[model samples]
Target: MFRVAVICLALSFSLLHAETDVEENDIDIEDESELRSKFEKFKVQYKKKYDQAEEEKRFQIFVENLKASKRMQEQDIGTAIYGITKFSDMSDEEFGAFYLNPVISNNNDPRPEEMLSADVAEQLTNVSLPSFVDWRKLGAVTRVKDQGLRCGSCWAFGSVANIESMWYIKTKKLRALSEQEILDCDFRSTGCHGGHPDNAFRAVIQLGGIMSEREYPYRGRNGHCAFKQSKAIAKIQTYRNIRPDEEEMKIWVAHSGPIVISMNATGLQGYRRGIIRPGAYACDNFRLNHVMLVVGYGTSRGYPYWIIKNSWGADWGEKGYFRIYRGEGACGINKLPITVVI
Candidate 1:
């Protein structure tokens, strides 16, 4: 009963945003000297070492991204704060190539007949929904992971996270599962390029189970399959897609476990912290390019947000996590939510 209610809430936030546009000059321009100084500081902070020619090229890109971040801050309707991040030095195209996976958004494959669909109603009935849910607090969530610039493997990380939490929820044992195994053995996906979470889940079942991170550590790039059946640690029987309702998603998170979701990550490159609620121009709902884990949800100072676990390392947004506006399908978040059955 509770699972049904939760799925409904998750779907509500997936369709509330209307498409809109913003002017190109929405950002505030800063002095050149000040911008340069900040760039130097950014380099020092991130330990960035570049040749003279590359330094100049990267500095210009950094400046442009700074302006873009400022524009996002000014045009944002929610309380999201934007600034320089580890990705600030890369251009939009570079960032997309390095981190975002296009296959997820372009995937048109039919759902498998054997794959179970989430049994959820459109709205809550007698089951009471919690106002908040945080799987990290419940010890079901693992530490934030880093996918690195070498691979666009957020799909593997997202699926692994969901499986880890579900495995813990069922067995009372939390294990950092191996995404490298999927990156290498999941022939259904293009290693270091992109993949679909459902594909990862299916591959897990086919491969018997996944190994622990210690046994099959991530290399941030494609490698020959080194999966040892003897070291397999966690497994899933099947996977389910939640109803496209935000309310139901919330209920599901509160009652079940974390969910693997794909969304538009255009505005995430410069995100520092705070709940991001950007306009459609900044974060298009139809442009889903990145996959992440929905660990929990709650309201922040009147702004309802989904606590998302990103695979961008602990130095990024909210210590390797980010919060997106709820009930609005922000960044196409509710477009594709899938979880595993352990």
Candidate 2:
């Protein structure tokens, strides 16, 4: 009786191992079915979200890809369909097929000469401010916009705008500072391609500072800057201007408040770079377009970076806000300016 019981136990253990082998063998085949089902379900769900015509068209394309994939080896089919399904969910801008095309070439090479050569002095020699150039010092607190023109003047617009905002913050008055004020009034900065915070700061100081937009409404399109007394609103009062060193920038930022500064961001235009990836802020390859107003800097992914505002209109990146690579001289390597009301 004991021998018979032991033999029965051994037989049961062998059966269990055999069952496990069968389960493992079935997994590969199961994977194919699971993948196919997943695609089918995804298609159905996607169809419901889109209009019938668009859905049908998309479905047809997906079907064609899936069928074509089947002719390849099973392994290839799994990989290809995985990619195909992902492509289906992407928005128009997210699509990378055009980027893959070799026909796309660099827009013009960076010409430092073209970027720096400005006719500000030639154009503005005759234009003069009113007897009283009322330049109001506005606030630095502003809603930064990502106006990804790829022209990269966003830094100039933002920094100058914040400088102008000091007028508002000081006297509870709103002033439209001149982007062209800095552009035309200062030979140091060439619009947006290349310039520094100090350039804008020095320009504001030399031009007897800036005036309100009521005195000078902005003509968005580029033209010869015409200064008129009829446009004269108020003049700005200059307080103590300090170009803070890197350590001083931090001190100023910590003690004072928001300040604008420039940074380098590659392909930051239109934000094709995926959802500000988890650890991407730590990346070192960002490019800088000289901007001003250093607000603050801190660590994000165990690495430090700047929290600078942009001027790319409200429609652009991260709602006109972006992260600058920290500690990389992205914002003048710690040599950024701090301005206050006089």
Candidate 3:
């Protein structure tokens, strides 16, 4: 009877070990499934190969980007922004060269001596301001998202876009102005080689305003200005440089219309979407680079931010716009805010 009992105990222990092995095997399968899913996402997002030996270098880079994105997601605490998992497939270097136009390729950014300057046209010192404002809600922004497309002509795009919005606000009619006109004609700016939107505004004025997109067309390259006084369909009464104060800039954006701005967009390279309060990085105020248009300002999850429109196509960001941490002079948010008074 004692021998029989010992044999039964040994059989029970063997069954327990078998259950433990099954559990461990299940965990291994789950981990592999998750990794496979990540690899699939990389393939679709970057349009790259997952198994090809010839593409091994790019595959390794994509994996590294994917891991960095995962780490960022895990480490960042309640950042009030959306996930960057969408950008997991593209390396930071690839993203920057494709979407960023902070500095032009062959030309230098305008020296302080060369940068165009506009005086403040109006100031709302004590006006009651709204808690939030979005020009898209006002139908001032266009639905057709513009694309800078590997060109340093973002300055021109921002300049033309804001002016177009101003024309809509003033005339209640939307007109697609030609950014190519500015890219080609604005000698002060170097087109794809980079330049200031401040100089871009000056170019529009010098050409007696700009022509419609249908007339001038965007070439995304620098060339001699083909000024056609006949095709000029939109004009700005005057352009102004908004005060560098955050409060005043809010007043201008809410009361006036959309405004153009140049800022240190270097930090925007890693951004995928969401209210981009740049983590672990601060923009150099002295080195303001890329130009963007501020369509509005508001709070997201109790964190105040500015809604900025980029020319890098809708596929790049939050339907062509992104939010940045507002106030505290984030990335020099209020620096060189340019808007037309039309």
Candidate 4:
């Protein structure tokens, strides 16, 4: 229930822009320097409240982890806070919009329903494993480069990709499906890309199957849909929802399968390599601007990693993917499951 509320909260706030009309009115009396001062004050207050809550709830665990890691230090917290709150260029309204507006508007989206259906339960029973699966050990998995194709269906693609990866682990075969097949065929789908993974899952189940991208072909493109290839698609056995639990994720390689998640993409999305500095260092404290697949978890070099595959083209970020540290309690994306047509 609380989990559903969090998802709803994120979705609602995800819609705000930094330069909305309401922002102008909100900071009309303050200049840029004054705005920075106010923002700093607010950040200090926010950080204090955040730290206190975290420490009170999990001080022993957090401190123990810090002690064991050696890499952990008070400096880590200071650096993260400093990095997040260091900006000073915006006017008061813009600065306010950057932080406060999204949080305030987040209240508008109602909480999502928490009911679990009989069909969902049956599917879960049949498809889910008794054992925890470590995705990094899974052999020869494939990555899908979903063309968002001007649709907001990144969420759907993310969900499907994670499911597909799981399917590969269980079935030892790779199958690519056309997003269009699911889009046009699924009645639950909001047309022109305005849909979520739930709709995609229902659509696949409704069709009773989906096709391989090779047979139907993605075309890195969209076109008129044909129902002929539906037979090639597979039916899902069942699935699970693994919401991001920072602690569960600490040993996550042993606790879950592939995960679908979303985040704010750094605008420097197209460049494949080099250190990516998302100019203003925006979104360090924000959430849900982009969706992605968490295919595996491991330590890259010495840093813990969330092996993420993105929708951007192949030229972007380590073969259309990148790794972020699974530390400092950042990147807590919801991981849901989809079943392969078996």
**Each model's C-alpha lDDT?**
0.77, 0.39, 0.63, 0.43
What is the lDDT for 217 in model 2?
Answer: 43
RMSD of each: 8.1, 22.1, 17.2, 14.6
Instruction: Point out the higher-scoring one by TM-score: 3 or 4.
Output: 3
Order the candidate numbers by TM-score, best to worst: 1, 3, 4, 2
Runs off by more than 4 Å, candidate 2: 1-140, 145-152, 219-222, 229-247, 270-287, 296-305, 324-341
> Tens digit of lDDT per residue, candidate 4, span 236-255?
75544433453343333343
How does candidate 2 fare on TM-score?
Answer: 0.46
TM-score of 1: 0.88
Model 1: CA > 4 A from native: 1-28, 103-118
Q: What would the per-residue lDDT of candidate 2 be over residues 1-342, giving only the tens digit for each residue?
A: 000000000000011111111111122333556544554665553233567686656655545444432322232211111123223333333322211111111333332343221332232345432211112112445554332323334444655655655555456655556565554555655543344454556666666656554454443323454554445443444432333244444444554444554333322322311123223333232223344344456654454555555453433333344454444454233432435433
TM-score on alpha carbons, each prediction: 0.88, 0.46, 0.76, 0.54
Deviation in angstroms for 84 in model 4? 22
Segments of candidate 4 deviating more than 4 angstroms: 1-137, 144-149, 219-225, 228-230, 249-256, 266-281, 284-286, 329-342
Number of the predicted model whose TM-score against the real structure is largest: 1
Kindly report which residue pairs in candidate 4 clash with one another.
176-213, 210-233, 211-233, 234-341, 235-341, 263-290, 272-317
Clash tally for model 2:
35
